[model samples]
Target: MSINGQPEKVENIYLTTLNEILDSIAPQNDLELSLNSILKILAKDLHFQRAFLAIMDPKSEKLKLSITHSPAKIDHVTYSPGKGVVGRVYETGQAVVIPRMSENTDFLNKAFGRSDEELKSLSFICVPIKKGNSKEDHNVLGTISVDSPILPMDNLLEHKQFLEVVAALISNQVSRLQEEMALQAQMLSQGPLLGGQEVPPPANFVATSKSIKQVLRQARQVGPSRATALLRGESGTGKELLAEAIHACSPRRDKPLVKLNCAALPAELVESELFGHQKGAFTGAYQNKRGLFEVANNGTLFLDEIGELSLDAQAKVLRAIQEKEIQRVGSEHPITVDVRLICATHQPLEKLLKEGRFREDLFYRVNVFPIFIPALRERREDILPLAEQFLEIFSKEYDKNIKRISSPAIDLFTQYHWPGNVRELKNCLERAVLICEEEVIRTYHLPPTLQTAESTATDTSLSFGEAVAKFEQELLVDSLKKARGNMLQAARDLRVSYRIVNYKVKKYNIDVKKYTGAKKNK
Candidate 1:
């Protein structure tokens, strides 16, 4: 039924036997269950001693035994790349079939604890399970191996070929399950905040700096309370992310989280947007609509750019906080709300209050629990960690294979003063991932803002050893150019022995044909 299609019979019995084995596994979706059933079938119908499937862990990059069925129930087994037969298959993407396990020197039988007598009578078959369809575009996920009894007239090559077909049929199932299980396992391990240690940052938040960790610690401490929190930071400093973190770990996490940007709306519509308006209340108020406060009842409300709210809207918000009620525009009826307020502003409220632009009563209410988020340049240590996190995210989003940032690019990242903060850094990395076509993001691939005199310069002498090597290589090349690629004359011109010149030429791996004007080799 497969592309390997109906194999011609070596004899009557073997042909029927191979067909039964192939028919038993029909590409089921439940990978572990299918593997368990395949092991039972191989043990019963084919007299196979043991069978196991090893999958590569994406995080650790180590091969771990994922599924096995035998007398000893093993939870997990790890093998370094190119350690034994199974490891060899995973590394080289090649099949290995041995007549006797005892004769193979690399067979470490340490995981299963097989006896010497059992090893002497058993054969081994290991084959790689790759992802892509073609040989040039595939990644070897892991290996499938089995132990068979060393009986008379048993062809190991036939068994190896059969196992290879089975591996190809189930490669997709293996990749999906491994990633899901890894993510679930991580979520379960990061339980609740314990002791007085640094609180874990929520998803989409990266806080490796001491300044940012302090902000998270305060957020965790005040999240459960019903107090109003005022987040202070510069523009693009991720104040919204901090507000979401507080809401995610709070008691009202399951309820709706309503967000509004005060500066984004027009000044005249600020009140109607926050507390709603009745039908025909204003020029465009066609019908009655529920405001953000009603939607955020028994939940949290994130007001970004809160400093930009008009004075009339500020007084109404203060009344909502003090009395737990709001009146829609053009309506005197009071509607109660039970919302936990979280306000963020990149501007200083003290300056606004001094200028009579913000209400003093509302400022005191929201500023009860204050947390100031630092700018990206203030926490320079988090540059690379945050950049790498963004690199991985955008690589998957754009379906690009850009792997890592080069050394020169990393130097530019840490040295640049991020006037636009974390949001700007995220955009820069996303652009880099989109434009980068290689396995690594070089300095030339970064944004123009990051392309400084240092990064874009063509100086190869960045170190003492590098400068010496550059000087020495240049001297040797000049001597060769003058001597027409003749080693003996080049050594005489440079006042060195021919043997020393020969060693330096090979050390630099220089080709002399261009310098010789396409002359014959000496």
Candidate 2:
């Protein structure tokens, strides 16, 4: 008989197994160890061939293998959202049941390197692990899946429901683990703490986006070589930061890295600034000087806004790059200088070359290895972490103790378009730090543009259910604040029974102590 149609004995056995699994997850045990243990029990008691958990990567938006009960050597496996059954469950925040893997054409068995023949007769069930009632909330963290060849197909619905309950039980633990990981990362980024003061460590490139990571990997690969690298990105996308990272990781790290902004200087002085000039070369040429080429000899010279260089300056730069020699503006003899060039530009160099504003040959020389840094809007997953880093920095600078960004503020941050990219984000956080009075930054502390955008977005995008949920949450918070977190009083004020209010509080996972000034008696 199918498990669903079996006697009460089978139902009792299932409940007992679930309770045992839940009880085994102790707070003191390692998360992975506890999860694996539970999976083993599930595989044995539930007659499943294999069970596994996959956690969603917030940056890449991919589901990565976390723990599995199978003995097969499956590691380093990842699936993009909507790629496989597990991924589809993660993407849609819904449960999926496959009665027979062979019949389902969409079933991709690549997650564990299993071929179609191996999974032909298996049945699969995948369910999302979420912390909130609303599937649209950011609380859908990951997915848990199980498969078995001998399991009855008629009880697929029963199995799906049971897996969902298991997922809900595990969601709280997963959320706690995620919070701990975030805290540890923040502490590491802040460096060692001595007597309540933060000793800042040397800055490093911070990014979690997969695209930026790929760019950084390419930078590291080319750092050890003498190849000319062209960094192309919009303004405020941190081109200079990538340039510095390259220089620091290069073989000439001990040598000086010279930087000059072509657009910042006058056209008349551009050539002189780059090639230097002899004593009395021009009206204000007071003494003999060394050019940037000589200063950066055996090191890297980062030429910012290379597209802004005049044709005259471009010719001299090309010659220096080609022959490894430069001539002082008024000197006859050419001086040999060895320097690696790193160029950056916000403008499209190809278009500039076509317009005769840039030298095509010079462009080829610099574009040997081009790295494109994605704009902030293109990598929204990095937004919160970057904002937190800035918050730590400006909080220290302003002598404030701001500890965190409120969830609502972070929601607004992820929604708004970052026109100015990372630079604008830093400035925004700095301003919020200066004006914030509490330890948390709220939505009101953000710029007016964010507020306007959020209002417009809510009006047009939020569904009726989502809008109702938002209003309900706000009402609960306000009621709790007024009642000093006394559930009885809050329910009376809202004209609801104490049982209903308590249920709602638990459903939302609201922390009652946050609304009350009272401390725990324990």
Every candidate's lDDT: 0.79, 0.80
TM-score of each predicted structure versus truth: 0.52, 0.54
Q: What is the overall TM-score of model 1 with all chains considered together?
A: 0.52
Give the Å error, residue 441, model 1. Answer: 1.0
Alpha-carbon shift of residue 270 in model 2 (angstroms)? 1.7
lDDT score, candidate 1, position 438: 74
- Taking all chains together, the TM-score of candidate 2 against the true structure is 0.54
lDDT of 2 by residue, 1-522 (tens): 235566556577678779888676744356778888888888877778889988875545677787787855656778788877877888788889998888888787765666667577688898998963456735678888888764566677787888888887787556555544443444445454343432222275677777777777667656766778889999999989889888987889999999999999999998888999999999999999899999999999999999999999999999999899999999999999999999999998867766888875676567766788899989998899899899989989989988777666777898888899999999999989989997678778999987677433456677999878786776676667667789898899889999999998998889998778742210
Worst 10 residues of 1 by lDDT: 1-10
